[model samples]
Target: MIMQVKNKYVYRSKISEAKFRQIVRLFALDLDATQISQIVGLSRVTINRYLMAIRERIAKFCESESPFQGDIEVEYEVDESYFGPKRVKGKRGRGAGNKTIVFGLIKRNGKVYTEIVPDCSKSTLQSIIRGKVDTNSVIYSDKWHGYDGLVDLGYGKHYRVDHGKDEFVNGKSHINGIEGFWGFSKIRMSKHRGINKKYFYLYLKECEFRYNFRDENLYLLILKIVRINPLFLS
Candidate 1:
């Protein structure tokens, strides 16, 4: 339905600009579909669709604003986290089954980027690092075997925290920043009780977008992104 919005903009949507913007506001507030439907007087299904679209938009925005967006000189922290419900009793760490692997990299005091990976293999993780980070920057991580040859990748310096020996901090050799983000993401995702694996990537990117712009007015930022991107609501 290609419709004109107030004679100023055209959108392939069944929703008016005002209604779309209202939905955007509620979504920016982090209200789930039920809460948003109650406030906006829309069906839960409709609200859910809009929310899903919004998350997709947010994912695209985060991808475009990746951490190393020409700012590769600064130091960085990298880590991999496994996300899943506690299904196997007494199982801890990446050995658990049905868990999704996510690789993340963050610039110190800057933005973050994340990806749903097949595994945390050295090749998988390091390839992402090579693509996003230049060798002129310092890299920090835990002393995982996967992170063994970061300096060999031409990085200026590779510092590591030996978590196995409880050596968490050795001056600037800490992955605390990315570790903190992993904790934050787990906590936030737990609130949803559970999510389908198919949509997990969208949720992960949403977390990255949110954390990267945590200090700013997210409502406005999202609104601006939506305005330019335009909504093709069903």
Candidate 2:
């Protein structure tokens, strides 16, 4: 029950490639493991396994395109969202419990890059910004204290939207795109009821991949990604 897409990487499975692809298609359609299991006639455990492998490959692909996409003046929006037990609403402080902090940077009209950070501190966020964003690119963000000092740090093109004062947009300087993505991610993730902390990174990356390529045929895109970067290394 092994299916090898390329010579080196192997996808060990009892199902045929077509069946596996059907499973993948279901997964791309955002069906949970239970739904895919029922349609594909596979056990939930088996379905979850394949899905995890697929997600691993997707995460790898997303990482390979890091520092955001396009070298030109692709305006970037940066934000941090908290995924906790009850809601997705923490900013600077992590509060308590299994509150996971995820930072994201999205190129305007392009792909999004995400990272799970220790905190929404200035240093933690700025390090990622300094690495991912170009000094010349225009950046947009809400006036979170974590996003402070970007202008002093050489990202002079940075713009801020004061959500505290209810100012979301100022000319073209708004973080509505990234903020919309946060809402999208939260809504989709809530369908799972609860996600385990250990596997949360993979899930977050999956969300990023889906949102970044929301307009494309995800099944084909995933297949292309897996084809290029095999899930299992020989």
Candidate 3:
């Protein structure tokens, strides 16, 4: 389906929205182009073209400015997760082998944001928070030393749940939401037996998008993804 906008712009595509959606369903099944073509009754070349377009469009969509403004009020939880080699005996923290660091923030009602960071240093973690979160939103996290002194930096409320003493929750002062997401992310990654670092963020974004939109049908959801064209049109 094509929609003409402003008379001067024309959108033409071979796939209808419904068919595009079906093709997307095949992709979600972890199928390759040839496999999707056989299942969806389309040429392999056509399927490849559509898949490439989908990836670029989604990347641009992620960078698009969100309408979320103001205090951005939502229950926020912050935490860090690691990705790397299997654990061995006697390893802790930095000793847990070379791993990439990921920071996560999730809302109480179930929205999530995640990104890769070089490390969990005070500067790195705090910078991610300042960029993605509204200063007035309450920030919840575990008692990681890296998060110390956030109040000194103008946050509305900085609450910590110390896991050292087995304190998981203190009247909703916990990071269980984000931590749950971290566990989910790891489980998804295990299917791929570890992903390349460059593609890790893309996979992470896909997971966050799926988790946040779990109520939608997987087939219809991906069809909407296939319809997007990423070329910048003036």
> How many pairs collide in each candidate, listed in order?
0, 0, 1
- Over 4 Å off, model 2: 1-10, 67-70, 87-98, 229-234
> Candidate 1: what lDDT?
0.82
Question: On a 0 to 100 scale, what is the lDDT of residue 66 in model 2?
Answer: 56
True-structure lDDT of candidate 3: 0.71
Local distance difference test, each candidate = 0.82, 0.82, 0.71
Best by TM-score: 1
Cα lDDT over the full model 2 = 0.82
Task: Return the lDDT, model 2, position 186.
Answer: 87
Poorest 10 consecutive residues of model 3 by lDDT? 4-13
Give one digit per residue, the lDDT tens place, for model 2 in 127-233.
Answer: 99888888888999998898888999888788888988999899999988888888988888899888888888888989898998889999999877876765552
Worst 10 residues of 2 by lDDT: 4-13
lDDT ranking from best candidate downward: 1, 2, 3
On residues 1-234, what C-alpha lDDT tens digit does candidate 1 reach at each position? 455555111255666667777887787777778988998888999888888888888898887775686775689999998898665887665637668888999999888889888877899889999999888888999877888887777885888888899998998889889999999999888877789888998889888888988899888898888777865654
- By lDDT, the best candidate is 1
TM-score of each: 0.89, 0.87, 0.75
Where is model 1 poorest over a 10-residue stretch in terms of lDDT? 1-10
Clashing pairs in 2: none
